[model samples]
Target: MVPERRRLLSRRWFYLLLLLPGLLFALPLAEEDLNAIRSVTDFYGQRAGKRMQAWRELIQRGKQQQWDEKRALTEVNRFFNQMKFLSDVVLWGKNDYWASPMEFIGAGGGDCEDYSIAKYFSLLELGLNDEKLRMVYVKSLTYQQFHMVVAYYPTPAAIPLILDNIDVAIKPATQRKDLVPVFSFNGSHLWLMKERGQGQLAGSSSRLTLWNDLRSRFSSEKLKRPKLNLDD
Candidate 1:
């Protein structure tokens, strides 16, 4: 039923009804999301051509599969994993940096957290409810390092399927014995993942400076699109 209702919502209607007219700030305002894509392209200059093409493909693909959550998840995960896995130190010369989806794509590579963040927003743009998706930070027991991945819950009680760049295959959280989830966050809320199932609120996600900065920039920026010619 949840999926069915989600399917009933058209992408155009979603942008017009939910986004344009000050209805609810449900998903980081569509304009900001679109602008981020442009901003990243502008920053990288010469290197952004490929990223721009990928961006077009991503958006076009999302429109094509907007109603199908499973297909959208599979494709977006695949799209981002193709990027090289570079650490924050190597990519941005920082110990830790939370990149916007466009920034992740613009650079052509990023760390685990960047992959998760980019996938999370891609899913959001594809019309998956924010409540059903999360960016989970986990401790990899195998590597003994902190890692991040996207988690999708079909229902509140159902097990989440992990979308990871490392594996390129979506697997249930229970099946991934190597990853011990520490916490999860979406646009609106944060959670502390427990051993039992699901998780509880940890705190406001606004506490994360990089996250706040990204969101702030997204909200303020504007993107310019090419003019459409109907008569041509």
Candidate 2:
């Protein structure tokens, strides 16, 4: 995995890896997709250009500084939580859809799943082990609706920290009593959650249809109306 290679290489070599084309653009916005972002935002009159510029700065700052795991959690959770939440029907014109991180930022709004997806990918890009982060599906007792969040395990056994859009705070899973875990997943594994967010390994995350669709469309930006002002 990239994180393994990152640990083996010196800090000097790690920075060089960032330069490799398509290896990972700090943010994966292509010129044409960016143009489309502008076109849609023109009518809305929000500064899409400036918002993206701020995102670039976040990526740069995160890379230059050696951030701790908790610091990485705070930085990423706070950044994307700034975006508005909309239903899948409103944002993507579907009953249920999952957007990639770039698509979530490009459109300026998405549902809970979007917040989790963006955080999961951004954390990985920041060099966290893929195994340490899992996207969890939970039943929100407060709202009586299904919701999603990103859980960060310092070690596989550590009580995971919850990164959620609704709360927009990094708290331990034990503190999130309102959320009843149903299951969890990442790129490699799927888990069937038992009581209190603990999970039993199920299978590959490929079992998730929406997640697979999101990955397939990640490189190809699907232009939607941009409404977020990141600088705001």
- Output the number of the TM-score-best candidate: 2
- By summed lDDT, the worst window of 10 consecutive residues in model 1 runs over 223-232
In candidate 1, position 175 carries an lDDT of 92
- The global Cα lDDT (0 to 1) of model 2 is 0.74
lDDT of each: 0.70, 0.74
Residue clash pairs of candidate 2: none
Residues 1-232, candidate 2, lDDT per residue (tens digit)?
5985675454334233323322443555557646645744553344443444445445556766768777888888887777768887766678888877666765666899999998898898778999899999999999999999999999878899999999987889989999999999999889999876558989999998888888887756554443343223
> What tens digits encode model 1's per-residue C-alpha lDDT throughout 143-217?
899999899999989999999988789999889998998988888888888872689888887766777877765
**Please, what is the TM-score per model?**
0.75, 0.76
Model 2 regions lying over 4 Å from their true place: 1-46, 222-232
